[model samples]
Target chain A: MTKQVVILGGGTGGTLGANRLRRELPDDVHLTVVDQDDSHVYQPGLLFVPFGLAHPEDIVRSRRRQLHSGIDYRQESIDHVDLETQTVHLADGSTLAYDLLIVATGAVLTPEETPGLDGPGWMEKVFTFYSPEGAAALEGALASFREGRLVVNVVDMPIKCPVAPLEFCFLADWYFRERKVRADIDLVYVTPLDGAFTKPVASQRLAGLLQEKDIELVTEFNTGEVDGEAGRLVGYDEREVPFDLGVVIPLHSGADYVGRSPGLGDDLNFVPVDEHTLQSKAAPNVFAIGDATNVPASKAGSVTHFEGEVLVENVKRFLAGEDLDASYDGHANCFIETGFHKALLIDFNYETEPLPGHFPASVGMPLLKESRMNHLGKLMFQWFYWHALLPGRDIPGIGADMPSAGKQTETAH
Target chain B: MPTRTIAGATVDVNDEGFFTEPEQWNEDIATELAAESGIDELTPDHWKVLEFMRSEYFEKGTGPTVRVLGKTSGVTVKELYQLFPKGPAKMAAKIAGIPKPRGCI
Candidate 1:
């Protein structure tokens, strides 16, 4: 009897999970991946697209071609999940049953969540790099503008790669400097948080950088609406930020189908998951990963990569009639580019905050630290993403566990 | 705060160390690990490297190259070698707090 596995979303999470399963699972397992379109975008590269550092064509690859030989790729929107019947309904009125299910239908940006956000000035002056179209469009808009106030705002929390907005600001500064119009531009970073970042230590460090770059930092500003016609943003407290150009990371929500499914997800449509096991609270055989789950971790590519490793192991254990391993640490690592050939790296798992030290022990790369080497590593990751990451090959020494070798141990203070 | 036993290490839940919380890490054996070989404490020169490394990571989310570290810290490659006898990988690993470079094995 063949065990059928249906995976929703063919993005990074779904694609990697499927490839790993294909390599590890037996011939008796049937794997099918569902996505809306055939095109798979290298989401991280989207950040660099606006600055002309990366060509849009370089970041896009055919989804089907990336999958394993045996996996089935279906092009259709998921209408909803019938958890009771273990069936998935397609937008075309078709249905498929599976013994096991994986939800990787990453989050979506709702520009409409902010009142007047999608009004007259959207894409013309206000844009978001979260989408491929918005990134490409902003490139042209930014190129022609000689000078004015450029406000980069995060409408709400839990946006993918929280540091990306800051990266945009840094790159924008570098861009204008190169164009010899930097003096005419004013960069302002607006967030709902009290500081520039979530963690206090990181916030203080990042706040200083913002000052060094001459970028204004406005914290705790909860954006209520974007009055595009009026060319301004209105916060909940009625404070207005007038801007010549606004790049907004609007509110984020889980898959559209999640809202339609009853008792499966939260109010935000994110699946209620067992944070440790990556299993869905709705069904024992169902698992969730990436931006689809309500996990208390940054919704970044590294998180998805770490989750895929654990999910594959758990799936194999479940098939063997063994106890499921409840051991998934929310390990997330990211390489942030700070322009001028500098980048920083941080590694933290579920129980570990990002610590300052070298990565891969007292010998490899530095952690929670910056170096031009780190920038090179960031640029090099694109190659690794296409090869090692997507192909499911294990990079030695880089496991699911968070290491403690190089970190400065803090005894009870 | 969540506590779990990983490879005999009684990982503390409230510790602010890297991988210090249950929401961030899991218990998986490392595929390969490099041998440790570097200074444990922060020397004045090491502090120079450490401060620069931490600043860079916070700004960009990656580690620094020895050349950049050298240029920023005003240390020559030969001086860096004397300070970190085992080379950049070992020194970087010691600084990053990771087990070892994944490719080192």
Candidate 2:
């Protein structure tokens, strides 16, 4: 009998896994993928949309077109997951069964989690770039603004690409400089953390960059509410930061269906998986990759790509009745766009902090240091993302293991 | 691999990803790093400590001093020494792949 494999969510992880598995599996195994819509937005590109560097049409493509021919693609909202039966229930009152399951249903931004955030000034003076619609709307708001307080607030931790908010501040500075109206605008970054990032060395570097750019950093400011009408963000301790324009990265949660499934996820609806194997703690046959897993790593596309390789290998190992290789390190690499034709690259895993040196080696791209080469690499990644990355092809030199080439190994005393 | 010098230290770039050999580290590595970079025998909370260290570096561009790492991780300076005998500067270089960070020694 042909094994039935059903994958959920047609985003980066799902799409790539579907295509690769379709090619890898014999004719006996059937592959099927389900997602709510056919549109697959280049999510990373959303950061550039608000700055008018890209058109909305350029960022979105049909998910169906991206998949290989033999795979079955379905368009419908996921209603619930029946773990006991190994089935997926659709919102349209239909169901499908799978011998093996992959949950790639990444995260959703919950603006409603905050009071007054989605209120009167939503998309007027306040906005978010997490969604395509939000990015388009923010473009207009940024274009018409002449001056005043512009605050970018991160409501909480575990948000997508934790450094993106800082990148936005850097790009905004460059954007205003280009328009010759930088001095007229005030930029401030507010986060719940005690520093600019989760890592200390990177945080110190980024904090200096923030200061150099004239952007204020408000640390440990847990958001209590967003008073959109008053153009202010109120902290849990009652400290208020007034703004003429606010861009908020709202609280993030996993797919709605995660909450419906018994013992599948946490309070945030993120699937609880063994931080190592990417295997769901609730079920042995089910696995998760990308933003969907409550893995203690940045929820970025690069992380998803890295996890997909490990998950796919383990899935194959599981089917063959062999010991699954519990070898997925929380490996993540991201290009931080610092604007003015400069960027920084950081490569890290769950245990190791992002170190400085050349990536892949000591002679290659500089790590934890800003350079124009990194900026170009960031721009060029869009092509690689669509062509090589999502197709589940091995990225030649970039493997699951973090390399130690470019680093200087000396014990500090 | 191309070599470049930034801030007076040499950095090697390996596009083909053959920078470090995994077998060098002992199989029985530290629990947290064993799963990722495979460094062993780490007793202190390196993740919590290094994450704070990276966050601070992101903001300021330099590794925090031993006193700062101690203050941030909520461990005493002596406690930090117990984890990283070489201190913050040496530990950071090993993790970040940079030359032993300057200015500390």
Candidate 3:
């Protein structure tokens, strides 16, 4: 008997999961992947596009080409899932039945959710880098602007590449300095969080960098309206920040199809799953990964990579009638660009916060310290993303678990 | 692997134009590679980092990170960038004729 395995969303998580699973599953087990389009984005590369470091066209590739030869790729939107019948209803009047299901749909930016965000002046004075079109548009907006109250805002938490907003500010500082207009731009960073970052030690380091760069930091801003016409960000608590030009990281949520599938998703459409195993609490035959899961871990590409290792292994165990391994420790890493050709790398997991140390041990890049090495690492990642990562090939010495051999564990209050 | 004609000799290079095979490298190849990377010529300081990266890769099967280049090669990170505006670790490795170094990710 042939068993069907259907995976949703052919983004980073879905591509890796499908490729890794195709390699793991036997020939008889049918593998199928669903995505809305063929354009698969190298999302990490999107951060560089607005800064004019990369082009939008070069950062995109065919999603179908990323999958293994044996797997089936469907280019259609999902309508919903019949959980009891183990079937998926497609928006194009089609259906797919799976013995096993993997939801790697990830998250989407909902600009419309914020009042006046998608309203007038969206592409004029206000822009977002989360989407390709927005990023490309921002390139022009950033190039011609000399200086003013240039504001960068994070509408809420759990945004993709959480460090990007900060990176944009840093790169903006570098960009304007290169143009010899550094003093003219009053750079302000607005966030809902009380600190520059989530972790205490890291927040202190990042907030210090913000101060050193002379970029004003505004904390605890819960934005209620864009007020694009008035060029102000109106907060729920009645606080407003005026901006000459606004860069927004809007709210994020899982795919709409997840909402259509009753009991399968949260209010935000993210599937509730075991934080360790990633097995959906909704059903045993179902699993979720990447930004699609309502997990406590930061939604990051590295998080998906680390979780894929444990999740794939658990998927194998699930089919063999054995207990699923719940060993994922929520390992996630990010490179914080601090301009002037320097960046910082931070590696942490569910149990431990990001600490200062040499990652991967004695010879790896420095943690929480600015270095050109981390910037080079960030540049080289685009090649690695297309080759090693999406192909799901494991790198030597680097595993899912966060190595503690070289990390400095001195607690900081 | 792809091959590029450098200094009238074809040698293997990756898509990003970094040398994949180190044994086929020579002075002329280094000069040609330097020109392609936007550096006019390999200076004495450039040779120091290049030689160090080549030795490290051939001996340990790994190239030097920026920190390693700064600490061990006696060339400061800032100076390395001045010579190789593209990047220190990557441009030096390309000129050194070694595969891309690991641990950046």
User: Ranking under DockQ, best-scoring first?
Assistant: 2, 1, 3
lDDT of 2: 0.79
| Candidate achieving the largest DockQ | 2
Cα lDDT tens digits, model 3, B1-105, are 889898999998899787777899999989888988888878888888889889888865678755456557787655776787655777789888899875221
Per-prediction DockQ: 0.01, 0.02, 0.01
**Candidate 1: residue A300 lDDT (0-100):** 90
Candidate 1 lDDT, tens digit per residue, A93-202? 99989999999999999887677899898998899999999999988988898989999998877788878998899889888989999999999999877688775555
Task: Tell me the RMSD of model 1 versus the true structure.
Answer: 16.6
Q: Itemize residue pairs with steric clashes in candidate 3.
A: none
Cα deviation at A267, candidate 1, in Å, is 0.8
Sequence-dependent TM-score of model 3: 0.79
Please identify model 3 stretches exceeding 4 Å from their true place.
A411-413, B1-105
Per-residue alpha-carbon lDDT of candidate 3 for residues A259-286, written as tens digits (9 for 90 to 100): 8998899657889899899999999999
Q: Which window of ten consecutive residues has the lowest lDDT sum in model 2 chain B?
A: B18-27
Model 1 off-target regions past 4 Å? A409-413, B1-105
Residues forming the 10-long window of minimal summed lDDT in candidate 2 chain A: A404-413
